[model samples]
Target: MSNRAKLFGALSLGACLLWFRAAAEVPPETVGQVAELPPMAGAHWLWVPDRLFRHSILFDGDSGRMLGAIDSGVQITPKPPLWSHARKEIYNVDTIYSRGHRGERKDFVVIYDSRTLNVKGEVEVPPRAADTGTGIALVGLLDGDRFLVVLNQSPGTSVSVIDLENRRHVGEAQTAGCAGVFPAGPTRFGMLCGDGTALTVHLTENGELDRLARSKPFFDVIDDPVTEKGVRDGSTWWFASFEGLLYEVDFSGNAPAPKEPWPLFTENEIESGWRIGGAQHLAYHRKTKRLYSIVHEGGPGSHKDPGTEIWVYDVPSRNKIDTFSAPNLIAPFLGPQAGFDATGMLGSFLSFVLPNMGVHSLTVTQDERPLLFVRHSDLGAVGVLDALSGEHLRDIDEAGLSGALLVVP
Candidate 1:
């Protein structure tokens, strides 16, 4: 063969190899598009993904079937989706950036119909800072779902109140050094400050900040800071500290009144290094009046570690009623070893190498047969457990569901 012909053949072979390598790197497409499932009866579970994708998924609480999803588009951070039973609507707050300018950004609250999942309306507000570190209640509905409150943090912290009925931005409230929005009353909400106090903001019927009040120091800000993710039981808000102390605050009145703090762990348990930890560590069941917490054994700085056991408590009696192991404890390290010694050894090694799985968020179904929804961040699995009997019902595998906020409606 000629020298030029030999060189041409070598180039063609090189090109083929490059094409094969590129094809191998490409991810396989999903089998089919996610079809919109009909909304089933009973409470629906909505979870917001922390990473990988910018969308919230709605699943049937009873059947563990995915009903639909609210896609937030690419590279956008969304607040926890809010569901209004009265109006049958889903509200999402997210930030949008300009095409040319990096600094040009706007925050928008988009409304969606619950049944069809169609875009109903959208209102633009000031841009908000994206803080994914702490689990904060950044969005809330107030005044019978007529007004929507959103927390904003461009460089400083504040809140924007939007009139949902009119689809307009009403006003903004300054909440410096404080974070998160916890609904206090029909026209009021509270924000946890860095000074160990909660600042309450009262809004008018038009969604303007009417007045503001700050509670006295309740927890130690320097020593053990309380998480912003508080579980609301009626007008009472229960906040958990890093060291496993439960602080109760009554927001039923004009101001947020702090109650006495209670030890979540016994003396022996404290000595055994039990502490409140995880992405979302506390859940409250109103009907049962029980507070469920994800706990783990850790040192002083391990308050953010994953949990291994769930401790149930009766808040009224201030008694520990029951304790159960998390489903992660019994989850198979490897599926179907089937007499394969290598597979069995690999499973054992994985069980030892991986951290103990724990509950990131917990929620109870609103219907009669209350099922506890537990999000295990380590395994990326959501387990449905019987709330009363502590039985593991089933597990739903979803990628990037870790550190997700679980909302039921």
Candidate 2:
């Protein structure tokens, strides 16, 4: 071979080897990449990433100035997979978590002063064999020394009495089978049972278990009226279940039960080509009493009714006022493992993280302003949305943070 030909052949072989290396680096079936991590902790009181793990958030209504972040700490299980943290919600407290001692098999509800962000004290739920933690999704700060802890989970699938003054163990009473507990009136509580039932319970002045009432919650569908449910303005209880049925259960029982639940936009009306589950996302305007529920459609490789639509229902009339498609609503696209890239706020007014798009935490502020905060699961971003204008507000990216968003009052 000529010297020039030999040199050219050597260079071509080198180039081919480099190309092979590059091609081998990428698997043919590879589609997604390891996304960047979410925001870290420590910043203005604005939104602490560590503050939301398996927790919840609630804005103090009376003051309306401070915000609360609650989370239950990590628990021990037969395996790490079985260990799950208790969901904490911010109300008049911060750092309120249910710490489970694996050795002792006990779950203690710890409350922290939001201002100091310090552990105020702890309240132990009724002692159990399995160390079932505080499954309290919704905790209402009624006044000083009293708060309502709703446990929708086992061991504590009832109401927990917490005495802030003493800051110690208190009594617990079995409400309905499931958690979904909300306050209806002073000393009275509302709970949605897992058995497609809603019951009202009255409490003693000193925070003792009182009586239970069977409510005639208005709904259109009798076969399955209870879909997904929540309490509105602490006065009316709303449930979305069985197709697009949306029903409002008045705690006062002043309103008559509806022959059927008002339809929030049927699946056919939306042309979603999917069965829409009733209980998607339920959030109520604190003062206005307007209720919002996300009517979602699930896609392939997704849970049944993965939530493709958001429905808004009027409390007074029990009617569907508006509906938005899932695609239009911002949400993170999940990879095969059901994860997404950690994309920060696209813009100040755009979504930072999409709502879990499946039974996520989405709530509008009590103020007249239409600001709404939604917790997106794919990326674990807390999304802020403009409810009135239906615009995407900035998002607070808090993936791998300390807690999960509970409720925002």
> What C-alpha lDDT do the candidate models reach, one value each?
0.71, 0.45
> Which number leads on TM-score?
1
RMSD of each: 10.1, 13.1
> Which ten contiguous residues of candidate 2 have the minimum total lDDT?
76-85
Q: Please provide, for model 2 over 226-250, each residue's C-alpha lDDT reduced to its tens digit, 9 standing for 90 to 100.
A: 5434546546666655554566676
TM-score of 1: 0.83
lDDT of 1 by residue, 288-345 (tens): 8888888888889776666768899999999989986676521231222122121256
Best by lDDT: 1
Q: How accurate is candidate 1 locally (lDDT)?
A: 0.71
Residue-pair clashes per candidate, as listed? Answer: 0, 36
What is the Cα-based lDDT of residue 93 in candidate 2?
22
